[model samples]
Target: MQVEVLSCMRHPNMVLLLGACPEYGCLVYEYMANGSLDDCLFRRGKSPALPWQLRFRIAAEIATGLNFLHQAKPKPLVHRDLKPGNILLDRNFVSKISDVGLARLVPPTVADTVTQYRMTSTAGTFCYIDPEYQQTGMLGIKSDVYSLGIMLLQIITAKPPMGLTHQVGRSIEDGTFHEILDPAIEDWPLEHAMHFAKLALQCAEMRKKDRPDLGKVLLPELNKLRDFAEENLPMMMMFGAGFAPRNNNTYSNSAFSSSTFQVSIIFSKQQPYFFSLY
Candidate 1:
């Protein structure tokens, strides 16, 4: 199953499956330098926290990969196991979806038949799995969207999906969503952060019909958020307080000391990037 699914699909954001030896139970795959997002996110002390920029890029990359899988030619594929651990990162911090052993292809014959796929076996990570599909065994592209939504929240908050669902869901209900944001991110534009987080919540809704279409809804929003984070915000803003204005449209920053982020870089009319001393 792994070999069949991996060989059939090809995309820049997907891990290339080179070969597999069933006799040895070994699968050859494209080498990922930075390793799985699981290690990068869960093992904080052992591995550095991925900077928000990289995290945001990886999130969008994973979404693109899933969108491709869910919209593949011949038949749409469902990656039953989609999670941070299954997403490998290259040297450039590009995210590629790995581990397709549990993938399923929705054939064209049953493409329009939503009530058809009622499998007894349940797959995918518990936290990232869709509640509706898990309860009814009625799978579709929306199930993948729900899982991706959980993964999105994990990328944003650096918290596990299972725990984050409760913490973030409660915060969203009580209007305290900012409280659960990962402490590693010292400074973030609240409006932007909430925009992204709320979208995740919508994707992981209990009802599949309530979730947004990946291509039309979620992807555009993610692209906008990624652009805002990557293009607008300075690198220094990830670690300290929000950007403060100086004279003549110049911007100043605060200080910080951390593994992935350090020092303050101020933006000025004369110097686009200038180091400031604490």
Candidate 2:
């Protein structure tokens, strides 16, 4: 049954299955060179911290991929397990959802599945697991949303979801959001930080219905983040104290007149200066 489902599935964002061995119960998939988000985020001395914009992009990509799975035809694929460890990244930093081992296919007509997948073994990491799913045996798309929300929080704050001293509920209520943010991202723009934080909060809502669907929630937040990055290009470049032009072709008068180009040049100088500080 798992093999049949894997064979039928096809999506640009999803991890493509190359082949499966029935005898060995193994599946081959397109390799993600960057490995899992967990490796980069949690592992030490791997690379400098992932920038907020890149983090948002990865989050958005994962959301879109999951949305495609949920809305797939014939039946929506329910990834009962989703966490940073399951999110694989390519060399270019494009993220793909992998490890469908715990996935459940929900047929449109059936509405829900009755096969009763056991939850005693811990379906997902402790921090990323939905509170509702932990309490109730019922597993659905909302479970994935909850996990994504946790991951969004992780990206913005740069901290593991569960390891903080305070409880998630208390920290949220006490307005100590900064306490949860990752220390490495010390100078993250207030606006971008707040935006992603709020979105994460909404996704982590105790009530399932209160949370926005992946389409409504993740995509819009990601778009806004992208726009923010574009707008700040000049500032980033300017901080670097002028960058060496990679291409000889200079901007035309018409191109210079455009807002994006203007923003680009404004920050171009800062690019070289910005990196020197580090």
Candidate 3:
């Protein structure tokens, strides 16, 4: 299942699946120099903390990846699991969505609209999961949107998602939204951050129907934020200097002596056997 889904994915924001081996249940992906967003966000394993600009870019990149998956041809795919751990960063800090193990392909009958399928059981991490989807067992593209909202909030606040929406909401209502902005970001643009906070809240509305359309609404807004980040490229470069992991060497299929190279293996009864060659 993972292989079939990954084989059809091709986007800069989506991780590239290089090769697969069904017998070994191994998967190889492009080596992410910086590792998962989780590490960077939490400063785990001595990972450098992410700056506001990079965070903005990562949010937009994740949104772009989700948009691609939701608009896939014939049948759209919903990434049932979307969290910082699944978002990997390359040597240059480019964000790419990974771990499609829990992805579900929506049927053609409802792919073109905002419809959902009632799965027998729920899947995904706790805080990032859509409340509605978890409660009703009905999944849709908006389910991923809800998770994206949580991630967006996480990017700005650098806080756990356990009760983030409520905290942000209270802060906004009390005209103290600035307080929740990650203090690590010394120069957080209060105005822009406030706007982003509002948008994140919208995406996390309790009802899935209230969430904004990913491509039409969220993508454009996130792109604007990304552009704003790019406009401040100098600041990002200065702040992020020497933070990226070493060994920035890049690889391509053509660069390899053989057509394939495998790095990791996994055994799972619920997952397809595959390898992502880096």
Q: Pick the candidate with the highest lDDT.
A: 3
lDDT of 3 by residue, 147-258 (tens): 9999899989989999999999999999888898888778898888888888999999999889999999998998898778777778777866322321223322121122
**lDDT value, residue 129 of candidate 2:** 73
Off by over 4 Å in 2: 109-122, 163-176, 230-278
Sort order, TM-score high to low: 3, 1, 2
- Which candidate number would show the highest TM-score if scored against the true structure? 3
Span of ten consecutive residues with least summed lDDT in model 1: 250-259
Candidate achieving higher lDDT, 2 or 3? 3
Query: Any runs in candidate 1 off by more than 4 Å, and if so which?
Result: 112-116, 233-278
Model 2 TM-score is 0.72
When summed lDDT is taken over every stretch of 10 residues in candidate 2, the lowest stretch is 269-278
Kindly list the per-residue Cα lDDT of model 1 for residues 1-278, writing each as its tens digit. Answer: 66656655567788876555555566667667777888788764586666666666677778878877776666777887888888987766678898877777776456445513566788888988888878989777888888888888887787867667678888878987777777776666778878888888888888988888888889888877777766655673543323222112311111111123221222323212111111
lDDT for model 2? 0.62
Each model's number of backbone clashes? 0, 19, 9
Candidate 1 — which pairs collide?
Answer: none
lDDT tens digits by residue: candidate 2, 181-268: 6777666776577677777777888766677767765777776776666555554444332221122232211111122211111222
